[model samples]
Target chain A: MPSSSSSSAPTPAAPSKMYADDVSVVVVLLDANPFFWSSAASPLPFSSFLSHVLPFLNSVLLMNQMNQLVVIATGRNYCDYIYDSSAPTNRKTGNGKMTALSCDLVAKLEEFVVKDEKLGKGESNGAVMSSLLSGSLSMALCFIQRIFRSGTFHPHPRILCLHGSPDGPEQYVAIMNAIFSAQRSMVPIDSCYIGALNSAFLQQASYITGGVYLKPQLMDGLLQYLTTVFATDLHSRAFLQLPKSVGVDFRASCFCHKKTIDMGYICSVCISIFCKHHKKCLTCGSVFGQAQSDAASETNKRKTIRT
Target chain B: MPEVRIVARNFMDMVASLPAMKLDQLYQNAFICQAIVRSLPPLAKKYVIQMLYVEEVVPGKLIEEWVLPDGSTKYRVAIDRLVQLRIFSETFDRTSGTSYRLNPTFRVNLQKHITIGGVLPREPMSATITVRLPSLEDLEVYAHEQWECFLLQLINSAQSERMTNISPAMMRIFQRGLLTQREKDAPRLTESGFQFLLMDTNAQLWYIIREYILNSEELDIDSADLIAFLLELSFHATGEAYNMNTLDEIQRITIKDLADLGLVKLQQGRKDSWFIPTKLATNLSVSLTDSSARKEGFIVVETNFRMYAYSTSKLHCEILRLFSRIEYQLPNLIVGAITKESLYSAFENGITAEQIVSFLQQNAHPRVAERIPSVPENVTDQIRLWEADLNRVEMTPAHFYDEFPSRDVFEAACDFARECGGLLWEDSKKMRLAVKTEVHMQMREHLRGQR
Candidate 1:
């Protein structure tokens, strides 16, 4: 019999290596900044954007029976988890209804957006606000860590950030910190930029964490871009030819002026970047002599020239 | 450290082996298509989704370019699997070296499934109609008990306390390959039955389900309809009660049979009756390679060959007794030891050393499961040695020929047997030779013709 023959083969004298199961837990960080979507320059409207995103989320869950999903809405000032497929409360409503996940996701997102809009009612005077991308990334990482600790089997966890808002230079340090943490945890951060300009923050995030960073040329095919490029799990990414990143913007924003610069004076004590020479570092309050500032600027100029 | 590997014939393999027409028919349902997509290899799934919206036939070289040079093997496997399942239809033309187009039905249905998901065929009955539905935990216990009772019935029909509920038809499915019955004696475990007992729960569950589906044809049921319904049933949320009025005649009967197997728990309320899917039913669509579906380990084996199983179930005790000697039993623990005599008897019953080692590893307590070798190395080695001892001697049937008039005839006969690839042994001095029973007739005819 097949069973007897298979069992007769000499068994390996070691624990079977654990294969990376096809299952994955995708934590989607969706940019929900109303200011970005409400602007006339935005390519995709909020409603149609959701129309594309809902199906993509459903596709991720449908890819594998054990695959999990978590959707966190990144608002201008705060971020909150909108939906989790593995949560017991979500499963209870999932019952025989196939669209339960989509329904729940949309309703919760609408509620969150309304509340966020109410808080920002006075600030909607044509001023663009950046979505809390850094906070959302940190939240996604924490959620992944919790899943890893709570279960014996670890599903391949990843973060997919779908944001169209422009980057806020003030949040550079926090975003970089989140990026490094994600890198350390081996979680890839996939970024899908739906805005006219490519997001420099997300480009670096994806590059550092070994994930796909795509800015689709046409926003009309957002769903196609999502399913084709961002739907792949980490395990399968090695085999598929994902869109290659052209280049990453590694320039750091200066703490003094919040301006991104290719070459800058960095405070040795706190590693804070500055566009111009400063006797006193604003960040760590460390003092520097004239000679030190002159020498640092000379080296910075040489480094920029060589590059 | 000896890994236990059960040759689980997963549902996908069965689906892949289906005839082309049947496969197309199976893919007609959106849920089945989704399940098929779920069961694909990771690369294959990516290919399907990437091609879900593309209407044109993609060149083979273009698909090949998607993988790195090192991933050629994976790429080949993915393409082969997709073609075998008919999810990707391969075409060849002189102009375009080779190309593949997604199966129209599969593409359309899967696109619909992803873009616009559909609800299950049946909806859950309202709380008022199906009052006091069992909790998820209770449903799990019910499913476990029912499955265990069914397996116990297989081991020994009289050993199961609740054998009365198992119909003769259901029992017949279990008897086909696992048991044999004599004219005047009760049914006995066959060689395969011993191996079946050593399989983990998920493998065993799949085995029975496969048998049930395979046997459905004899009962005048369309196997295709049964498969679709079963896969759809897996999509139902566990512990939720679905109204029975939604099912057709065949489904109604199938649901009853499934209840006996503990896939679903049948409940009756004041004026309505509904069935609640248990974890088992909900896990049906999950591929067998997914080890996460396995229950947590409960058996802890020490290096000294002593075992402590923290399970109170009688089924656990009975299964343990198959290859180990039971010392004593506590309310929540079963103490056992792996001994030579017990292992020898187990080997005699056709259970292999690997199965025993794997059974132990699979059931190792969560505390020790993290260890490299869940079961002690010495115990696994000794069990393997004992099994090797039984395999030391092998018996083969042969026909011995002697008393040949001349060495020439004997030499010719030897050459003839050798050429036929059935020569067992030969004695040059005595002009005697032994040929395999299968080739004896040919050898005898050749010798007679030479004379």
Candidate 2:
């Protein structure tokens, strides 16, 4: 009711509003991090995750008759298409197609975890990390491009990344590249973080792509948050006044060790981030102080590379 | 004017004609309500969803605020359509105070559909039918074949001989004595049939299905039950066979009828049977205005009026014949030309230039479809001009008067005719004047009153 009364005035010539029924293609990126989920700090338990995600996917699919869904899992070994509605209508004729897809997704995730465990069994505190956001996003973009380039009624695609685990610092460049391409294609990359802290990479992805990034206070209302905030298509999103993000986390992860940093030093030539002073750049192998020892020269170099 | 004919009523229009109480009753059926919501104009559907959970009648001013400043006209139009459908109830309150709300049953039903995914009247098909269900592709083929036969029968295309028989119930519905003569041996195509061919697939489907619903009374199938069943069929999985046992007597009969019509395909199993929804049935609940999705093949129309239709469907070829004269046909290509003779015949058969152009544009080859104006400008305009030529000399109700005694009298009559605003033609050489038939008496009285 804030600007309710004042917004009621009519314009001289009302534009002919058209609510288009363009097909919506949604690619869901699930972070299959076993280590994160097994930890008690995680709000979304693996079991809780399956229940919410499946229903949310179904609801999204049911929202429009022309809607298409593709679910990609970032497993330890590799990223794979877990479920795709565009694939030949489910071959398993006995089970309901949706339930069949759901079971297949569950089985695949379980199999991925078991495989990861076996691979990590030998070493002490061996970590099984598998949140390949970049790979999944690239694949999603390719899939969108393929469908849209040929068809008469190409669907408007949006990617939803459910990030529970930490960011993959190694994929910093790849992730940013994907976000920019997605932004260029008008494909919003919505991210829902269910874990402890905010993901710097995901926050920027959502912001740049004009999609919603939500961190719910109550993990129990994850489905509610998804259906209400993120379920809307690109057209409806225009009219909706979304939850205002207080501030964007503009901090960049260091290129050298893939670690998040504040007040980081950078190599001017390569534009690579470093936690502290280094002679040789790890990214592009650029020698920094060896070439220019003066502090004023270093300041000039940094000034040229201002982001 | 030649002979009074009943204006056609499409399925949606028939539903729109139902009283509020009947609409309320129909809305109680969740599938019917959902289908109505889905098929409504996009703006109207948006309005319905916005008001779905609102507690009370929202003020008209609030509606205006919801859309952009330039969207007020769309808001009003959307509301008007909603009111017509009895989905949105409008209450007058002088100027900006007017308020509206969803019809109670429609709100509850659509809400249940969107939120909880309302329980189906019939349970999901048990394991028995699923094992032997037809593949999606086969179901699609069967459905398409059946629908093609049905259309072929209506137009009495050469392929109608291939069809076994069209159901009497359908025949009764299709033939309303409008332009159709109920002759059995050779069902000649009427002007309406030509116009029907020019309509897009979605519109044709709606027209045919609505005709069925309208004739439901004579067929002894309740209109409400038929609508509810058809709408429910749309929500079901396409190409998946469901247990026929789950359907009641009325639904089972309707399913058989629908299967015959190619909306659904029925597969016989060991113990029982199952009905698999085809694309036609599955698309029933989709937006009626989804014209863009119906782009099947490219029908290329060149500037020289040569038409090349790259389609394998006989139905497409037969429809093309309604406007363009076919020169020859190959396995996957049809060569035709839009000639003056063809255009005149098409125009005479009640096919408007707009419909012909739209049909051409819709079926335009991908290369042509992508062009700014899908059809060549010269061809579209020429077609329109041909149709316009038929209407050039408009008949009017006017009386011609001549031979005034003097120039002043002639001037007076001319003045009277002009003042009446009914003068069709005037000539000073012969001092003749024409006045409308309705105004003739008034003019005569005015002249006498002046005298």
Candidate 3:
């Protein structure tokens, strides 16, 4: 703000600081779990999902010309960078009405899902349980760090995770790491849960990063949920009366069984969680006496609520 | 206390004043559309994007529903700004409510930009037109060197020998317009010139650029053409030199002139010359650069009234001389003191104390910049006090009259002067009065009528 002018002052306004702002960068993390698309409970088919998401992404880019979009696909055993607008991808469709970006993002997503379906059909039952959500998140963080390193001043970067799979406890540590970094960097992770069940980790991720966590009951209205709740950037989020989750699942997954637990005994040395009290900590190998382990279980049980 | 209305005008104030066709030409260019989009408030940007794909003029009521009911004020402001920029036009009907439609050209251009990205910037330079231009770092240095020299030449005409062929018109825009030039060729700061000197570089550039745009007609170029070309330059790859031969005829001429302002750097190549858009050129349309914020002023002021400026440019030194008494100057340092006499000269030339204080605070050295208040409070207060000294007791042109006929007559005369609205001062105790010079004859005529 310019200093207040005196009585004799003749409207000396500050010259417009036209080119002194940060550009908006959006990283779209599309969850391409083949298992979820094939599931009977899922209302969004792969093609329908792509059709709706493509236009939503188009509107995101069209929202602001300076808004840079990066699409990442997280599949069963793979997380890949689908498309980045920063790189020149001029592969237009038959007609020029739609951007090569929209077409390429859809095509690449299709290829990713098909490739994942083949892999999922193979002798890998464990892959069905996970969608590489943690890996995709870490990759998004790395990409954001790369952008920041390039000296783009505080480009309003955000991550919108169109999640479909249930949270995998095996990748809990990595996901938490990504979540912490996202929190530190002030990049919100908005999660749109269209899956059958609620994802605790995704809820926590959104909550920690101050991003919206919307779980629309009707999967057919995926586009509306995304375009309305998640379309806004960090700046506009200030004024928006966004739909916020009433509660965040705060349960920790114990290291011993790698299970989400309501009550967990912590290893005194490293704070590693365990479903059952152990004399020797499973993570750090620190030994607590049998009596101490018994006492720890007693306190853990006392802390657990009946609900 | 500047008039509150003064703060209401801003950069877009001029754009709104432009003729409808001229403003339409501006929105026709994708770069201008993008630039205008970038300048909008975040909420307004959201409104534009939501309306971008809509087919027809959406009713304002329908558009208002996009945001939450609580965000109505923000929505109103966004629509208002969009209308002011001519991005959205309001349509009215006898039966229906107000509606807004995106300007057709702006809508088409902005849509095209999103679909194809930056249209390869007017076709790629031919493979045969390979020009080895200076590196980005070297180009930035060149820009600064040229810009400082240009500004220095304006301050001290003797420095013109070292400077290159500057646009005489740009020089006149700065000197002949702002400063009063005597027949002998010496220029003194006019009231506005002092204010201009105190402004930050960005404001100074805009001040001059707006003047240039206003004078674009004199240059025989359409104002819209000048605006479109300049805004399009922002889309140019900054530091990555573009072939000069690729520029259109108008751009070819404009690019060379822009080089004088350090907005673009014209490099010499063995085969053909190329132009590298500097940060200044690229940052022309949008206020979104990190470099401009951090790399502006470097001055340190002490409570003792001494000033140390960490600048090697002659431009900085000459600008300091505007309001400070220069003690001495080293290679990369200038030591100066704020004195009553120096400030009086500045105040006399229409420089305000606030401008001077802000100039110091804005340019405070890095060490002092970290402090909450960059400049010491006492110094700012003292500078303001000195300025107040000049205007505290205003001089009025009036005649003093004493020893009136009687108390009743004196009181009646005072009332008459009050009615005429020309009474400067009146002392009822001594029966002395002062009447404005213009009202002197009228009051005298009234007094004769009273007798």
Q: Which predicted model would earn the best DockQ?
A: 1
Question: A1-307, model 1: which lDDT tens digit per residue?
Answer: 0010011211111212343457678999999988889887589789899888988898888888788899999998789999998788773433343467777888898899888878776774646467889899999999988976976666668899999999988887788888877776778888998887778899888887778889988778888899988887776775667798897776677778877777777666666777887779887789865555676756743233101
Question: Which one wins by TM-score: 1 or 3?
Answer: 1
Q: What's each prediction's clash count?
A: 0, 4, 11
Candidate 3, overall lDDT?
Answer: 0.73
Give the candidate order by descending DockQ. 1, 3, 2
Worst lDDT run of 10 residues, candidate 2 chain B, spans: B1-10
Best by lDDT: 1
Flag the better candidate by DockQ, 1 or 3: 1
Give one digit per residue, the lDDT tens place, for model 1 in B40-106: 8888998998898899999998998988888989989999999999999999989988899999999
Evaluate every candidate with DockQ and list the scores.
Answer: 0.37, 0.17, 0.21
Q: Ten residues in a row with the worst lDDT in model 3 chain B? A: B1-10
Please provide, for model 3 over B224-298, each residue's C-alpha lDDT reduced to its tens digit, 9 standing for 90 to 100: 787778778876766666778887898898888788889988778777677778977766764321114445458
